[model samples]
Target: MRRIATAVAAALALGLLLPWAMPATAASAPPAAAAFRQEVPRTILALVDLREEDTIRLSRIHTMVELPLNHLGLSVVYWNVADGLPDLSRYPGLRGVVTWFAGEPFADAAAYIDWVGRAMDRGVRFAVLGQPGVRLERGGRPVPLALANRFFARFGLRDDDGFSDLTYRSKPALADGTIGFERTLSGVLPGYPLFRKTDARVSSHLVMRRADDPASDSHLVVTGPAGGLAAEGYDRYFDAEYNRRQWIVDPFAFFRNAFATDDLPKPDVTTLSGRRIYFSHIDGDGWRNVTEVTPHAAKRVLSADMVRIAAIEPFPDLPVTVAPIVGDLDPTWNGTPQSVEAAKTLFALPQVEPASHTWTHPFQWIFFKDYSRQKEAPFLDRDGTYRPTKSDDHAAETAGEVSDIGRYAVPRAYLQQPFDLDQEIGGALDYFTRLAPAGKRAVLVQWSGDTSPFEDALAAVRKTGGVNMNGGDARFDADFPSITGLPPVGLPVGTERQIYAAGSNENTYTDLWTNRFYGYRNLVNTMRHAGAPIRLKPFNVYYHMYSGQKAASLNALVSVLTAARATELAPVAASIYARIAEGFYTARFEPLEGGRRWRVRDRGALNTLRFDRASATAVDFTRSTGVLGQRHSQGSLYVALDPAVAEPVVALAEIDRADRDPPAPVPYLVEGRWAFSALAGEGTGEGAGFRVAATGYGEGAMVWRVPRPGPWTITAERDGAVLWTGSATADDDGRLALTVPLSGIDPLILRLRPILRPSGGAAG
Candidate 1:
């Protein structure tokens, strides 16, 4: 979704200082003298003008600026500047602040500039794109020039008393070719504020030149240790029509250079157990629709029932979280007795993680945040139909007055009663929990309609011991080419955060399910892009229950599952993914030194840490504690942390050293096809026996690198009863491979013991 806003330009040319330059390569950039020993360094504060920006979802900060930061494994906390500056001290993990403004500067310009100066004073970096808010007026007069110069001085630049409007004759040129990637700047550029470098340490990464003169060069993007500056039009390029936009700057390299993140440890939720995570989720839309798929069509079976039989029943190997709209299951609402039975049967499946999609689906959650009963009274009807009545009497009164009510003519999908946060969160989850089989509970609340719930709604879900997810709608493909289409882990709502689904649902793939019903099969393309080059997101098979309504849609849904079955993934429940996403915002990483080591704490349910551009590093098992295994992919090391251990220490050493002078025989996981966990080794040398647990469908396949090449026997038992006993010898690489037939969802305890042999080659 794209929104149009007024684009402001402040093309001032100030030559107040001497020009100097710094090296532009990351290799040449000097390291910070001291590490943030206690800081998390994951959250970036983004300032946007909500007046024109609407919400974070529609803001350029989230759609454009957040793309690179998210790819760099960082989350953004957006703040409306009109609300004044946020207290930076509260965010100890505050890595930096980025601004993208469209409207006039906030009322107080001195306060905004001083806030930036104060943030930089605390060792926090500052980056400004588009409007920097430096040029402002208070009570109809310009802010003091000294305050603006001080802001420019942070990036080692001085504002010159110059302005230019000859942008129609200017084009952007990269100062360094190595910094450019993918899209390049073309056509005439927009007018921009001009500055001269005051120090040699500041690097000019980009420049603008006049086509007519060919000699007038203005610094477009400059960066230093304190932060950087990306002039207007340099961050993103809008077409002449302003209909589409492409990144003119290599955001990955630019933000990396801007934030000095060459050695930062990124908390990665993209992978688990040394493999990319794969999960699936179903929204509760169209649950009552009847399936038209061949055999099911003649019987007039409910889409929910057909989905369970065709999708859930056949794929016991993959776990899918099924959230039913509470109103679709409760008989008092729009649900029938048959719908209730279908929901109960689906929740009983061991492969399904029961969840709730809210009591009555609120089309636009923000509409009810500050709901007014008197305002809604004229349009409301409580005839027990749970449907909105034709409000011809109040049509004119309600028309053009409602905001945040996306698409839907009414505020909610069902409107028999007034909106209630508790009912939508806790009440809905409680109803679903009762339908779930013994021991299993609703672990997550799937956001309905707009999916943008308020802070209280998220907090209510947390109160029910459940997590919340949806919203984000992350997708990256040919249509939505840039990583901008892929949102970060979640959005911060006051004290609570709303976790987003990893991938967009079928509704997006099928163009709102109106045409191209088979387009969902192309989801593999997004899965491919999100993994390669850099694994930015997990493999998520997200769709609506309505996908079962048509044969083409049903086939597309199965195609995605079949493709997932063929990939190397750690398949987990969607609730587990929500928890992992929650962990991304809460996990604290205390850097030990450089980026080689970190003391990770409070990483609840988050089980992995990734270090990019670390191909030469390997986990130093002897020096590290609470490590399960590590895998090197895309030139990055994915280290899986043991959840059983509290406050694990991850230490990285040279891979060459670990390979040459290998440590004593210790069984460590290499990779597995199933979800593996709770690995513990006992004894020493060849006598060591490792105990691990796993659960999955299909055939259970796994490999563990042992101390030496030799025969090993694996005894698998469930609930103290031996399920199977198998043995295989370690190969030249000391990799022990085992295969077991997994027929159910019960967790299996597997014990791997080295089969000792006599010196004569006989069994001992």
Candidate 2:
């Protein structure tokens, strides 16, 4: 601890530490000490046991509860119950606590109960799934009925010393409109009945009935202001053989009603500029592999070069973040001069955002948590090279730990030297930044191999001022067939968080890139599903540089990009998407005017907020501050906020009705292809106009809903140089359309001046 403090002090004195970076002391302690202050209470604490197979990543709660809560735009903070409950008071805007335990009870049942009671005392609601903590007891003896009932009473449930009716043949029945949604309820329900009766305040969503006894009906699911309970098998049904989960209880309705999340001001990351966000990122794998494609194959061109020539150069309208593996680009490793030159060329592109894929790609990141040179020595090949050998495969087959070893035969893709976290994270980031042009440093770090770096590794990436992304491998299509396949926005990695790539790469689609190379063409299906019905994720085109090795894989990538270009989307850098995801976890909201207005703060780079089922509402410009404009899509109103504003107040008002007088004209943004910031609107007379800084790709398509009907001259300028000037007339409803051709990614200043006539009418 003393050494850490000294190092931190030295770093602070030398100006080497970023303000947002996690210090060594903070990383060792509960992250809440640093996070809770700025973050809003939009997080649900999910409790699980690391000793059990059911963890936060692969538990019933992840597949059932987490997915639904994500749809409600909520973030999850996972806590291992064995670690004891964190100080809930330290965490602000904590919506509630959730628990789902299986098999034997927790090690200390009494302590668990006491912690839950303490949380309840603080007005933090608890949602129990499968086994309730109060019901769990040490040894064979049961918890006292008085103590158990006290916990149940909080949920409006009254225990009558009854537990499980094993012989009773019963089935679950959905209560009218409750319970069954998406997946229908079927088969006999498992019995471990707890409560016989409930208070009048309880709402029973699902009930169980006995086949023979008419009076033997028990509450399978119940909820109230205090929280809810779904007993045993009624919560979810997991098919162990297929590794799939089907919900017997509707997760959306359950979480919404249980947590009261219906009207919360959700910080949405999916939409921007009134359209779905589009972003692309490429992994640095296969950068040196020779292309097998036509034309490029004749010259023995590297896959990375071919990808730059074909996929990247053609797409000037889209921004793609290129993350190069430091081992592939640095000459000290196996990298050649050609590889280094390719990386320098790629990072110089105007549309490309430079990033790092790590120094040595660790295949099984968990193995390095307690790294041991002796333990890893056995896995290295006898030839001195760290590549996989026949012996390693035989050992893996005999050990039956294929999942533990990950995709590679060894623990890490590069193991020539001892594992060093600093070299793999910070060193790689610095190496990539040096390869980029001036003013364009490495903005993100893409996790390689297993993509599950430990807490310290994640903190190291944060310390370097880089956003960590990759992992989750989110996919939803006919093959995966369920929302359960879609992971949450990101994972809670102890003191740090890892932002996940929005969609899976070509490897998953092509069965590890062995066959069906064209399988990635079907990515369009996952992209479409992720958006429609409900916007669960943004449009992310994630792939490897190796896609250029085969014509089919490269074509599939081009096809997806073409489809993305045709769609109405607000294209942003991969770093922007990472920051937006970070915003979802850290953004704070203060609801005012009975939920009609919200003061959003500490949102990071997330510049858009969405209100679902708000077709009748519009941004009240007069009341709203720091608002750029508004756009409506799929029955949801997306309000664009100016990132320059420290705290933006979004006020929603009813749309002007026929019965009411038409509102005075104010030049307000309707929609734009470019991203806007530092927006300021002024004057309602002849000089009535607005000025905004815009940055984007392709031709800038924009429209403004003006305050009055008249001819308007729009001039776009950059550094006092007028790029273009055009005149257009506002329609009767007051919408003036304009276009500004964008040739670069830099922000341009746009000023609109109303061209008035003597008669205050249309002019030629």
Candidate 3:
């Protein structure tokens, strides 16, 4: 409970400007500000460079951002600034601008210079990603840094100007032997609208000797270590010829270490090394003298100031966040009957949200670059399917790659096909569309290898209502990138291994063991990644098969998820959570006098407006359809938006002031159902009964919500027949403890009544 409150407090702080938001009207207010009230935008512009930096992060900026953009509110129209700048005049309701600059913006210094000048003239907000710009020398002027200085000036930021501050979040403490490094990380400062936690997970990373330009108004949403001990360009610098050196030691090394990825069976005999005993005997606590397993890494308890690791187990009291990405299940990949059944059953649960990874999970971009020159388009197996083939006659082959004769290796030719829009997107969705249990279908498309598609491919996917997600938050440099801004940086062969999202967890799960930590602390990456005047961009984080691929990855993910679920940040499905994100990000708190202001926009979305006083709230309307629902969220009044509508709706001073603010919604207890609390007096009154709307919930499911701490009872009935009744005690802060099945609770007005006692005794 203390942790949840801390998280909420952080989120409610809103933005960098603090208690009061800075006037959207900048020093250079545009002529459009004349119609300021009417012209405030319901949209934001996200200009990205579509490129891949590392083999692990993937390329294609848009692939990973759909969920965040949609869930946050505000429609975004993407543009490649690489060609210079777009005509921003069309974005009348444009609130701010963000860019994943990378190395491109610097290369085209002249074009970006023009764009930055225009942005300043128009009083726009800008955010930046990656390093400000690379240092180019061996010539006349240090001009790249100068241009970066000016570009950031538009957002009230100044580069470090060759001055830098050094800070560390975690130290590389060696373990006694090989438990691995201590597997722990920083926590978050909950409640911040953007960052899930307040811990300087990213901010610490952004700390540089002389890289970032620090601005007072620019708050670091995330901060973490400068880099790991073995970080490239730091402890381990690879020269240009390093690749050639690997070839010499590679062949012999492969045969030397036989079982590196796995372990050999524990030897029955133990040699007395004098220091320790190894008998292959497992301790009662599973702490084997040889092999002991611990609980998930996130929950590992620590004592003596982090000297020891305690094995702990923690379960999800909140809804499970669904990754939805499932692969290796296509029939061609040995999808057996039992495997198919298990897949279906696992996804059928109300909690699991399914996603598509194409029928054959092919490595997208790398394979394309390696073999696109092949006349066959390598692995072009009918565009969507893979068939056995061997066109290469190369003698250098591994047993696995070759046929029965050797089977050691096959010729390195076309291994897998590139992005097949039709087979992968449309056909791949077929299983989900058919298998989805009534009312639900896969909404996200998980990419294979985080390969982003071209405009044509993206259009095809949008036509099917699927959104792409797989690329890292900012590493979009691999897929022949479709850069948005003016300058283009980084050659195709460039590699950036810095973990940009480590502010919340300074150490990777591996780092917890290895004691090597470094990161890119900027989330949204700018004036705190956008305009310093506004709150920071939503601190977004995610992991991939590489962040996991090994068993250690699971520990990393679980630890992170455990932290997220504990806070109010734990949201519903990606779709709904996306709406909430939209509500938060697109929220425009335009302050009027006397605590009167235009709350968050309702442009095809919903928003919650908290007030110090519930005194006679009146609302006006613009393009909004109608108020969908209302309740109390964490002690504040929340208005649910009907995303289906786009017209503006105003909540004037005439809105009702009621005490029936339910603490939270229990939409998770029963999927597809709307559950909220209302003050109950009798059975028939102005404030009576918890309205359980027939939202088409699933079977055998029940949902609920309570406003305040007290004993509560809910009786579900239909027609005149009482179907179900349940009771539970709420905490002081209104914690609904319900225990009942959906025998007949479909859609009914469940009037929650206080038990009446005969004499004054207790009644539950």
Candidate 4:
């Protein structure tokens, strides 16, 4: 203790205390913490052993309970009951204790018994998942002893039947002899590979329980009564992702039914449930159900304000440009309304959020550029003054133009020449915000393929306080996967594009990799994607609007979501998705000299922050003033700050900082200008600014920093012929700019041979 104090004092002398170290009067904790101050804990104590198989099983159990608990504003504080019961005096306010125990023989039985007795006296209830080995009485006669019998014996809730081969169907009051009633909710997604197209369209599974049992505890929030699928293929309890077998409910679909029926226990934890975001890209889907289902999804959302919702992200920049094959106002080209009334209804429900897909929706890389000699063309040729230039109709049609769906099988990236920040992200965002309902402001900024966006464009987005969900997270599995494959732990959501291309038809057009499937193939992908629900972290799903045009694709969509529901997968709102996704990557617990610095790069999961400073004051730099307090048990401190706001610094909440900087990410361009760091065969660039591959797969940029006061010769060639070339003096300010167009056949290069500058002026 003396050593710790001395070190803390020394660190303080060195100015290592973060801003959050100040007292509450200096700054406030986040709102979440403030809420904690006013209530008895809407929390439960979770006892676990956390051994091998238990980890996976426990994780699934948590997933199953997430929605119900979250809805009821309840949290669980885990205690390792494996060795023996830990002290719980600190958590006296906890509403109850729960475990998924089959009576794992434990040590210090006496102490556990005493703890349970005390807890029961304090009115702290007890619950378990499944049967957990309880003694059953048949016709008031004691049958046989089973594991965890002490628990049921103490509760005095007699059950006439022991664990039996019983099936509980999740239907509307169709009695199967279980406690309580919960109706099943089902839906369909047509794009995935797994789903029973002919027989069982709804993803279904099994559950195990005692025959003819009654509710064990009164006001017990959970009453498990599940059903078997009528379909033959999905009858048994198989974790299709891993091919594991056991007696349990279909983990994925169960949560969906739970959320839909509101059938689980009331929440004892607080949730950012209302804080949401929706991400959509319009590459043009068929109007069949998309036109119909768009309204259907909307109508479903309108009626119940379900946990899942949709927000439109149209390419509003298209219409204002020159006439072309597709116009901005045309639903096909985006930048237009799919349905004004739908938009109004969504906006009114405060359920819809709008995002920007740029005006022209060009390849996005080079289109925002300012051409040195040609910088004045968009304004000169299209308009006057200094407004950002709109891409010509040709810009919307060619190789380096807008993203044309099904244009290429494997989407190749290229440098967008003559690009500008204002034209791409800024202008689009501005235009849409004006057109959007006052309540439906957009927060998502999507790119053609989440290619390298300029740092400036990103900054402009952040200034509006929005996180960019701009990348692919994963691809669907083929035919079917019995087990789910987990995503790389460190990967952040939306930043990963995990692709698995298999189905009836697989093709690549422009930047899109399309794999269209039919009946069985769709079911395969659905089960495979749904198999490992735990592995589906860092979440984001994207497809061209075209693929979802038919039921061929939508089936998988339905299955994936249905699986997500049963597995307790919550589709975060676009408003908060970026933050939540990023949080997995950025959240940290830092040990400091005198204290600790706990920070998450994105909005954190509920109660993710639990420190030991009971009296410490915390302030969040992300967005909240912060609520500072600790849980009663073990002085565990959890902060209540806003989600996803960046730089949420916790003060006084930390012991101290060592003033260490984390290693930086690999060096890459922060600006829109691309500089090559390496080449395929040449190895590293050795400090050279750019590298080009023989196959023309690389990054290149032609950007100038300082302005020169003179006309300049500039040329851009597609093949053997020059696509564009011009000479003009720097307009007014003497600044020059350029963008390299992205293409497939040959690499575009800016050459040196001839800029004849007069006199002694140096050619930069």
Which candidate leads in TM-score?
Answer: 1
Alpha-carbon shift of residue 722 in model 2 (angstroms):
1.5
- Mark the 10 consecutive residues where model 3 has the least summed lDDT: 274-283
lDDT of each residue in 16-112, candidate 1, tens digit only: 1101111133222222423355655878888887877777777887767776786676778878876777988778678899888764556787777
Model 4 C-alpha lDDT per residue in residues 117-161, reported as the tens digit of each score: 677676666654532323222123332433233433344322333
Better of 2 and 4 by lDDT: 2
Question: In the order shown, what is each candidate's alpha-carbon RMSD?
Answer: 11.2, 8.2, 18.5, 25.1
lDDT digits (tens) for residues 410-465 of candidate 3: 22212344334476567767776566566556555544432333345445555786
TM-score of each model, in listed order:
0.87, 0.86, 0.46, 0.33
For residue 5, give model 2's deviation from the true position in Å: 33
lDDT per model, in order? 0.73, 0.73, 0.31, 0.32
Structure candidate 2, residue pairs in collision: 41-93, 41-94, 665-707, 666-707
Whichever of 1 and 4 has more TM-score, that candidate is 1
Clashes of 2: 4
